[model samples]
Target: MKPLDEQQAAARSWFESLRDRICAAFEGIEREAGSDAGFAYTPWDRVDPSGEPGGGGVRGVMKGKVFEKVGVNVSTVGGTFEGEFAKSIHGAGDDPRFFATGISLVAHMANPHVPAVHMNTRFLCTTKRWFGGGADLNPPIPYDTDTADFHVTMQAACDAHDPAHYPRFKQWADDYFYIPHRQVHRGVGGIFYDHLSDDWARDFAFTRDVGEAFLRIYPALVRRRMGQAFDDADRARQLEWRGRYAEFNLVYDRGTLFGLKTGGNIDAILMSLPPLATWS
Candidate 1:
């Protein structure tokens, strides 16, 4: 298969792997929470009516009754990266070709106690250029222990790839996951970068390793915490905090900006938005 085709296949396979991993992770979380948190899985596929040739996301969501306060959503989108990609992203110079092949993944956690997470890996291309996707995290509620634990796990994964990677990538995540005007942070921020120019072996290794680490670490974290039993007041407070998170994504998140700019399908782009969300 050609490089693009190969990348496409890899992305598809990765999506399935991610979905399965997250499902298992949440299942463990539900067990720990001592409740059967049901999952909402939607495999959506649609062709653009605008004659654009691609659309929609295959998505999965989970919410436990015991942990009814917590949930996780995962999805993948394959379509033309036109208006949305062009307008919303930064650090990428003006170029129409960045929309060449559209494939991206984003995952969100509903519990404020469990950090709300975001990861996106895509295959971007132009007539003369190409690069694989990258992943990052955005946690709305920052707990030093969880935040530190999260970064520590990721750092270990990156360190296994390159010792220097942890500090730099962790800083990158901090910088990338931010709402500049608010002067607060989007969670504590985790490693984020675009079009890194480095040895492919090392970069690919780091990305792949981090992916595995996510599978290894997050599910257990969620299982341990999700259904621990928060009061309605706690859930209410979480929803209030989620409202802030929603504002950042809708108003300032680069991904949301890019998705909207590229003329992405509204539903697909907005899938990143929680089904029901509020702000304080």
Candidate 2:
């Protein structure tokens, strides 16, 4: 693989910086809860048959008094897409070469009232380049205020770029996150956008704003409800909800499929799964 160009390097750097900020905020939450816990980062590399250097990522996770389990990962990788998958990627029709950088996060709170959430933002290039990612809330016990706050933040981010972006992506999230087999939506919707085209500079700006929106809004919600009391019934609900989350991620999520297809580290790819989940 060739060296990363300026755009790709910048995207990767920003993602790493975002990961650091998010981990710091979550650790601060743990500190407020009087837990000594903080994130532990493990680095991993990708395998490419051509002996090309396919860049790697760091998997950062924290288990603490407030956050039950959270994984925040950032990676920048360059390589060729394999066989059938090549046809499906944007610019890989003839040339399967690709470069991608992004951050992905999934958080499951210790308290059921404190919602679980997922956020990811990525920049990918093949023959063409574009940005993609969004965040969503998954509360076993929903709060109207929390849902509204989440959407409000995301909407503001989108509207700043294109007025149509918020409604369009919010609906995209509503559609994309659905579990058709289970006949249910994943959670209270946030926003999901992919292939945000036009130009790299503008698309990157919007992507940064989306990350900022999540970084600002989600920790606030977590702090608000992390101390709430819950009983066994609530615990049971959270577990059952985790079951749904696990199902969607393993079966329907595009990111999960992408990671697996690209020979990503198995443990980091599977880190989105809840620490504990129950079905039926």
Candidate 3:
């Protein structure tokens, strides 16, 4: 790939920094629970179709008393999108060359009461450059207070940028996260936005705020519910719910598809899958 431009470099730097801070925070939670669990990082390189050196990323995963399974990954890659896949991406239909950098995370807690969560934010450049991503909460056993708090925090981030952002992106998330075959919503909705190519500084600021909001609200929610008591029945339900999450990611998640199309590391791409899950 070619050298990154100013905006691309900045976005990549911020994403790696966010990853470090988040890993530290999660390790702190483990210590609070008297477990020494910490993230294990693995780096992988990407090869484009032309056998050129595309950028790579590190995948960090942790399994502990508090977090049953969690994966945080940051990757920056550039290459020529192959065949018809290029047509679907924004600004890539004609040129087919693209660059992207982002951070993605998914956490599944040991306690059923503590919600599972997913968050991702990315910047992509083709003929056009833009930002996209969001966070959503998925609790096997739902709680109103937790749901409300999550939405409120995300809304504050959106409102800081544009008042219209929250409702619009919230609806986008609601729609995007649905499992059409199952006819059920994946989880309590958050915000999802894409193709935000208006003002570089403004969009970048908003994207960073989204990451900050996730870092702020999710760990608190984890602490709130991670100590609650759960029975075998609750564990069963959590497992069943994880089945749905798996289905959505495997069948409907655009990020998953993007990773496959772009020659991303298979293990890193599939890290979002729960450690355990059961259908029905």
- Clash tally, candidates in order: 17, 0, 0
Encode model 3's per-residue lDDT on 148-189: one tens digit a residue. 999999999999999999999999999999999999999998
Worst 10 residues of 3 by lDDT: 1-10
lDDT of each: 0.56, 0.93, 0.97
The prediction achieving the highest TM-score against the true structure is 3
Off by over 4 Å in 2: none
Top model number, lDDT: 3
How many residue pairs in model 1 have overlapping backbones? 17
Tens digit of per-residue lDDT, candidate 2, span 71-140: 9999888898889998988889999889989999999999999999999999999999999999999999
Local accuracy of candidate 1 as per-residue lDDT tens digits, 162-264: 7887787777767766677777666666666556446544555565666677766666555545545556776576676566667777887666665555545
**So what's the TM-score on candidate 1?**
0.76
Give the higher-lDDT candidate: 1 or 3. 3
- Compared to the true structure, candidate 3 yields what TM-score? 0.99
